[model samples]
Target: MTKTKIAATSDVSADKVLKSSANGQSVLVAKVGDQYCAIANKCPHLGLPLAKGKYENGVITCPFHGSKFELCSGKNVEWVESFAGIPLPGAAKKLMAMGKTPTDVASFTVTQEGEDLFIEA
Candidate 1:
C-alpha cells in the first residue's frame, strides 16, 4: 500500500473532521479520541464531498442526503443493508446463512507515524 502524510496530531481534535488530498484522491480525515481514521471524501451515494457533513457519535452524516457512515469503518447506516437486499440476489439470505454482519460502506487504512496521520493508497 502507498502511504502519504496528511496531518500532525495537534492539527485535529476528537470528533472533528477535515479534508485532505492524498494519492490523487480527496480524503476525509476524522479524529476520534487519540485515533485517526480516513475515508473517501465523497459520499458514495451521490459524489458529494463528505467534508461538509456533520460528525457525531463516531459517524458522519452527509450534508446533502443525510446518509450516515461510520467513522471507524466507513460503513453506511444499518438501514442500507436492509435496502440492499432487493437487487443483490439473495443477499439477505446469504448474510444470514454466513452469520456475517453487513456493512454498507468501505474503510481505508489509517496509520500514525509518531505524531502524523497517514492514509493508505
Candidate 2:
C-alpha cells in the first residue's frame, strides 16, 4: 500500500508525539528535532495503546507493566519491570508473564511531505 498521511509536522513539536491511524494501522509519530520516528501505537506485551504511554529519548514506555520500546526500530528495551513507574519484584513480574511474552512494538517507515507526515502502512 502507498504511504498515508499521518499528521501535520506542525501538529507534532520537537520531543513530542502524535497518534494517527490509516489502513487499519495505528501509529505513533514522534518528532525529535528535525527527524521523525513512527511506531505502532499498541504495546506488544499487552496490546495496550502505546499512544497513552510515555516516550523519551527515543524510548516509548508502556503505561502498563513498564514495557519500554525504542521508537526508531521498535525494539524491546525493557519488559515488565514495573507499572506506572513503580518498580516490581522478580516473582510478581514473572507471574504477570504467565500467559504473555515480551515482544517488540511494530514500526513503520515515515517521511515528511511538505507540512504533513506520511507513514508506510
Candidate 3:
C-alpha cells in the first residue's frame, strides 16, 4: 500500500470534509469525532463528485441523486432516494436508479502523523 499525504489536521474540523487526491483518484476526507475517514469522492449512483454533498453524522449524501453513504465503512445508507432535489417514492427511486445496484463507496484507512493526514491507497 502507498501512503499518500492528503491534508493537514488543522484544515479539517469535526464538521467539515476536505477533498484531496490519492493514487490518482479523488478522495474525500472527513473528520468524525476525533477520527479521520477517507472515502472515494465519486458517488456510486451517478459518479458525481461527492465533495459537493452534505456530510453529517459520518454519512455523506449525494447532491445529484441523494444517495447516502457511511464514511468509515463505505456502506450504502440510502440509495437513490431522490432526484435533483425532489424526493422520490419507492417505485420512482427504483426507476431513477437505472438498474444500478446499491453499492458501497470505497474507503481508505487514514493515519495521522503530527499535523498531517495520510491515506493508504
- Among the numbered candidates, top lDDT falls to 3
The whole-model C-alpha lDDT of candidate 2 against the native structure comes to 0.82
| Candidate 1 wrong stretches, greater than 4 Å | 78-103
Clashes of each: 0, 0, 0
- Encode model 3's per-residue lDDT on 9-106: one tens digit a residue: 88887786788999898999888887889999998887889898888999989999999998888899999988876899999999999999999999
TM-scores, one per candidate: 0.73, 0.89, 0.95
Candidate that beats the other on TM-score, 2 or 3, i.e. the better one:
3
Model 2: CA > 4 A from native? none
Pick the winner on TM-score between candidates 1 and 2.
2
In candidate 1 the C-alpha lDDT for residue 117 amounts to 83
At residue 66, candidate 1 shows an lDDT of 56
Please report the candidate that would top TM-score against the real structure: 3
Quote the positional error of residue 52 for candidate 1 in Å: 0.8
- At residue 92, candidate 2 shows an lDDT of 85
lDDT of 1: 0.69
Rank candidates, TM-score, best first.
3, 2, 1
| lDDT computed for candidate 3 | 0.89
**What's the CA error at residue 55 for candidate 3, in Å?**
1.4
Candidate 1 lDDT over 61-99, as tens digits, reads 766545579887888873222222232236654543245
